[model samples]
Target: MKIWVLRHGQAAAQAATDAERPLTAAGQQEVRLMASLLQGQPLDAILASPYLRAQQTAALVCTELGYERGVATAPWLTPDDDPCEVLRYLAERQERNLLLVSHQPLVSQLLSMLCEGHRGAHVPMPTAALACVDTDFVAAGLGSLVLHRTPADLSA
Candidate 1:
């Protein structure tokens, strides 16, 4: 299985609620750029944090790729949520390729957990960044980093 993890795009700083925070104009454009980069891939599924920012980013990517949104909301992808459960869930999924759109610390933590098998080691996943991992879904913690890209890299 191949998993693509993406951090949510930049969002407004002061929103009425954290869950209500939406992406900025620049963030939307950055997401478009990221979507374009992923256009030709055969993504089997998209799992996202329930936060508005992450949901919007996933929606944009699905629209650009012409794939009906097969998005699943996982609480583990939410900010500060435990990522081990998310990893476990992904390991059981039947999809060969999955995309996950989420927030900072959680996204960062999840990548580190997937790559290193533990957390606390920082893997900075900047806004609109993506990390691709190839692994055997049946065997947990067996994966290799295939690619990592940030919006700036895409722009360049």
Candidate 2:
């Protein structure tokens, strides 16, 4: 199975609440460029945080990929959520390929847990950064980081 993890694009500096933060214009552009990378890839479902920025990012990806299935909002994808919970949930999913649009800390920690089998390793996930893990099953240490790219990398 291939799991694609994407951190939401850059957001406005301030908002009424953290979850209310919206993507800036630059964020939308970044998301669009990042989404192009997955144009021909098989993505069974898109799961994203309920945060406005994440939702916007997911929408841009859908527009780029022409993905018909709407994004599913997952509360567990919040920035502070536990990576273990995410791992456990993914293990039971039937999809062969999945895209997760979420925030930082959770994104980085999840990648570390998946790639290193533990949470200590730091995988850099800037805004709109993306990592692709190929795993036989969804478990810590069982996956390989086949691809990791950021907006700067893409632009370059």
Candidate 2 local Cα displacement, residue 62, angstroms: 0.3
Could you say which candidate leads in lDDT? 2
lDDT value for candidate 1?
0.83
Assess the local accuracy of residue 46 in candidate 2 as a C-alpha lDDT between 0 and 100.
97
Instruction: Mark the regions of model 1 whose C-alpha exceeds 4 Å error after superposition.
Output: 138-140
lDDT score of residue 122 within candidate 2: 89
27-101 in candidate 2: lDDT tens per residue?
Answer: 999999999889899899999999999999999999998999999998899999999999999999999999999
How well does candidate 1 score on lDDT at residue 117?
79
- Residue-level lDDT tens digits of model 1 in 94-139: 9988898999788877777777777776877888988888887523
Worst 10 residues of 1 by lDDT: 136-145
Extract clashing residue pairs from model 1: none
TM-score of every candidate: 0.93, 0.99
> lDDT of each structure?
0.83, 0.95
Instruction: Give the CA lDDT, 0 to 100, for residue 153 in model 1.
Output: 89
